[model samples]
Target: MTVTVADCERVQTSWFQLRSQVLGSGSWEDDGLTWANGDLMFPRVIDPAALARGVERARSEGASIVGAWLGLDVDPRPLAAAGFKKGWAPWWMAGPIDLGLPADPRVELRKDAPGADGRPPRAWFAAARQGGQAAGGAWAHLVDDLAGVFDVEVPEPFQRRGLGTGLMQAVCAAAASAGARQVVLNSTPAGYALYRRCGLQRIGTGITWWLHLPS
Candidate 1:
């Protein structure tokens, strides 16, 4: 089945729910459809009219206005004209198959336990180099049958070592273990190639907006 913007929204909603659980804030749907995750993240506003309302509310409350329009092919210049900075424009990818973990013993995968201070459970897959230093790490949140991957990063020295592939495999394993049936994520321009290599197919487009970088 072709994934649509609604599917992307489901992934985003699940992600923010997990984030809010960890951060002690809950997300609410504003203007009937936009999802706002408190002040921690921007509201997902699509309709220009709704976006205007959300923007005004954000400005009035001194909260950063940042959000995304997924799969909608809307021109973001209007939002840019409204004083929001256009951030990473990502391609939404989803795949049904789980690319299994790598057999290489040089890298290890570990699922970090929840913090003692009441943070919710999150999947942290660290790819350790042969020398024991981490080459990279990826974090994910699995809600029901959907998993949203985020913060996949590798240091410059670790590039070209296939650490990213290992991280993707580990993340898929963790998500499947948690009963996820499909994996969804917004990929960076650099990550697009990596994710495609790992069996995920690009399904849609996503763009984010920000008011100001917090100090």
Candidate 2:
């Protein structure tokens, strides 16, 4: 059951959709643009024309900044020409949910309860503490049997102590317990090596283009 790049893309989109819904924001697909409203909005663009339309729409809606996730195959020249500065290069990685890292005793995993209507939550959060102080945290979203991990962070002072790996182990364990068979994540350069050590392979790379509209 090797996951393809397309599978990773679908899971990423699902994560964003669930996030937008949970935040009470809106999302829509117009032409080649997939727009989701959030503090860090990524309007997935398929081509130069879609990028142009997305910029116009963001400006019309009074957004100060917006971003686009361009897959490796998408030419970034158009984005740069459109005044979008380059942003982070995130590696799309995926692997079996059993990451094999021993969980740290200090890490606590928590899952949201089902809604009043009995609908299960799409995501859960994990946090790691050192001496009863917050060291790091992360979020995992499940869409069907595939889970996507997001926002794994450890403070500077608390870093280099394996808290990041511990947080990942805890979240993957939680996802596996909840019936997820595979996990996917977009890893920045900082976390890329750690994720590789956890047995996830980089399936592809994506560039994020950011734009600040004129006032």
Candidate 3:
């Protein structure tokens, strides 16, 4: 199964839920914090006033907007012209097989077997030994249609090892177990080819937008 344009709205909404609950708390719950992980962290229905207020709170508390991401359905130029810089434009891709091993994923990290109900739990794998120590890992999530990834860096000295591939396989297996259709992520140029080699493709471009608060 592939992700469609209609999925954009859902993806954006889901991102909000994740950013909210994961970073701190959300408006959905009454007990959320006064200082929130606002629209800046991820693509959100931007309310300028709410955002300004949030930023002020963060600054007063000695916090800053670390990063921002949002999935788009229309051309991103309009957004960029509005005062945001292009961070990344990754394709949201999907594959036919969600479970089972890829043709040759190589090496094992930790395997989270699929749940009894026919869903695989999220998993990760890595390989890149120091003196035979693992260097890097790749992983994915299984949150409904919002399934996605996590990437980690291997210490500089451990570069060029296949730890990255192992993590890719780990997430794929987990997605398969979870019965999810697609996995999405924001990619930098360096890893684009590796993802393609792993059977992941670019479907739609994702962009991040930011506006400097008038200081």
Find the candidate with the highest lDDT and give its number. 2
Model 3 worst lDDT run, 10 consecutive residues: 27-36
Name the top TM-score candidate. 2
> Where does candidate 2 stray beyond 4 Å?
38-53, 56-62
lDDT of 2 by residue, 1-215 (tens): 78876777777777777767777554667676677763223334356786677677667767788777767776667778888788888788998899888879988988878777987766888999998899989999887888899999999999888888888898888888878999999988888988988889998877777888778
Q: What's the true lDDT of residue 207 in model 1?
A: 66
Model 2 TM: 0.86
CA lDDT, candidate 3, residue 200: 66
TM, every model: 0.73, 0.86, 0.64
Question: Could you tell which candidate, 2 or 3, scores higher by lDDT?
Answer: 2
Please provide, for model 1 over 78-102, each residue's C-alpha lDDT reduced to its tens digit, 9 standing for 90 to 100.
Answer: 5676666767777888886377656
Candidates' lDDT values, in order? 0.66, 0.79, 0.53
Rank by lDDT, descending? Answer: 2, 1, 3
Q: Which pairs, if any, clash in model 3?
A: 98-176, 99-176, 119-177, 120-177, 120-178, 128-133, 129-132, 129-133, 130-133, 138-167
Off by over 4 Å in 3: 5-45, 60-62, 71-86, 97-130, 211-215
Candidate 1: pairs in clash? none
lDDT of model 1 at position 149:
80
